[model samples]
Target: MLRLQSALGIFALLLLAFALAENRRAVSLRQAAIGLVATFATAILLMKVPVVARAFGAINDAVGAISAASRAGSSFVFGYVGGGALPFDLKVPGADFILAFQALPIVLVMSVLTTLLFYWRVLPPIVRGMAWLLERTLGVGGAVGLSTAANIFLGMVEAPLFVRPYLSQMSRSELFLVMTGGMAGIAGTVLVLYATLLAPLIPDAAAHFVIASVLGAPAAILVSLIMVPETSVRRTGGTLEDPEMEVASTMDAIVKGTGAGIELLINIVAMLLVLVALVYLVNAMLGLLPNVGGAAISLQRLLGLVMAPVCWLMGLPWDQAVTAGSLMGTKTVLNELIAYVDFSKLPADALDPRSRLIMLYAMCGFANFASLGIMIGGLGVMAPERREEINALGLKSIVSGTLTTCLMGAVVGVLS
Candidate 1:
């Protein structure tokens, strides 16, 4: 039953993308087919290949090491609340764990490490290699290829910075591909943060988040191709340029990266507080409404009814659809952080292992309305001339990104 739903879900999702196509006739079957093949192949390579699986395991261990290192820094500043030995005995195990002091600092450490790696020329080669493979696989130019490949590790706004010179030259379809790529993947900084959050709930979570990002890239391309097929000729005039400025030294890179991460930390903190509070506020308002079948009509319940079918189609059992749907809906509407937090708090029996795994893939993206604004604002500054065009495609990119991840979930459902 799970396999049948997952297999059928792929076609259903493709058809939905087709139905949303700007020019249905322009959608290329060859591109979409290659994308599907690439996504599955990437997943199999990362998850099933023994050598690669062992490497992924090593990476997960490294994530643990990185977390411990961050806690060392935090422990000095914030003491035991950050992760040090407790001065007082705890009545409840791990009740002392604090998100601000412990989990969020991973962003700071990762930001510095990513900058050092890039500044030392370690990341450029790997990014360039990924770009080359993406170009060969997806038939994209250097600009789109670099942007999409980088989005696997970099944030949506930061990834496109590498291809800033070519932004004005990309076709609408190619431009949409960049936007969709950002929507479908999470940044490495947050990857560690999330992996830390879910490490207890899901084994080797850093590897899973990494695999989710890998799976998202090709799926983003396929969905973007379906929605806004290439109608204009792209002008690829030169080599890919990394717009990252040169730092004086590794110290400079660490200082600058920490500064950049501070901004992200503040934004994440503020946004989560506001959005989560608003969700509860709205839920309280909703509490006044009449009950349905003896169940309270909260936002989660409403979203579950709407998105359960979507999750079900992604191969979750019918009994768990509402639960999975709530997480998906929260990720789409609020953000993945909140959704994943709620998922972590679920009882052991709330979702089976398969359903939990599927939800992880489905919710691994920046597809909410919030991201649309950020993309528009960031791209507007990066290429002011393309502001109108960016505005035009902003809303549709959300749907493109959301469907892309859902397709990924369905693919994982089949393989898992």
Candidate 2:
């Protein structure tokens, strides 16, 4: 019965994309079919096949080791606040951890490691290989495919830089795909941070987040194509470029990586501080309103009211749909970090196992209002010539990206 709902959720999401398609007649059913199949296949392979499942499980271990290493650096600098022994005993759950000191620092470690890996020629081949698969399966050109594939590991803003030279040359559909992929996926630099925050709550949280991004790729591409079908026949070049090669030495990599990580960390901290407060402010404003159904009309409740059906279609039971939708709403309006923090604070029994897993995947994206602006500004800078066109597609990309991740959650529900 849950599987049936999951199946319907997938079609409903695709139908939403079709309804918003710039050229509905140009939508490629063959491409969409392949994407749907790829999303499910990727999930099954990563979670079901013994050998591959073990690999993802190893990823869980790897993330733990890496998180400890990050704590080493952070703990040295920040002392107890960064994850060292606490002076006071905690009675409540999740009170000891500090987001700024502990989890956000993981970005610095990841950035440095990522730079060294890229410098050592590790990530390029993997990205190229993935892009190759995307090109073959998703029917996107190499440059666009490479950029979209890179979003699995890189942030939305950073992924387009992989195909920086080709931005202006890419067709509108291809550009939309690039943006949609960025919105649909999260960065590896922050993946550990999220996993660390979620570790105590979800088993193999790291592995699940990794799979979320992996599965999200095809879903993003599928929805992108559906929303903005490729109407042009422009040829896209295959060359992939990276600033990593420009690094002078190991020290250079560390310095540059640390600098990049610091910027990301600062940005994340700032956004969290401001956005969480803004949500509070908004709820405060809403507090003046009269109660409805014995509950105040807070932002979460209102959002939950609107999103409950959507979450229900993704296989969360109706009884739990409001709770799940509230989280999804928090993710959409406040950003996934805040949503995750809120999710982590929920009582364990608030959501059943299936609902918890489904919500995790569904909320895994940069589909908030903030990201929409970021996408517009970032792409506008990269390809000034296409700024107007990009502006036109920004809202569509968010919708597409949101649907993409929800579709992935639906797939997870069906398979589970």
Task: State which candidate has the highest TM-score.
Answer: 2
What TM-score, computed on C-alpha atoms, does each candidate reach?
0.75, 0.76
Query: Model 1, poorest ten-residue lDDT window?
Result: 234-243
lDDT of 2 by residue, 165-226 (tens): 46787889999999999999987656777888788888888878888877877788888999
lDDT of all predictions = 0.79, 0.79
Cα TM-score of candidate 1: 0.75
- C-alpha RMSD in Å of predicted model 1 compared with the true structure: 4.6
Pairs that clash in candidate 1: none
Clashes of 1: 0
Off by over 4 Å in 2: 22-26, 63-65, 114-123, 141-213, 228-237, 241-246, 316-320, 335-357, 364-366, 369-398
Per-residue C-alpha lDDT of model 1 across residues 55-170, encoded as one tens digit per residue: 64564466567667888999999999887899988996447778679866776776677678767777556555755666677877666877887677666776775565467778
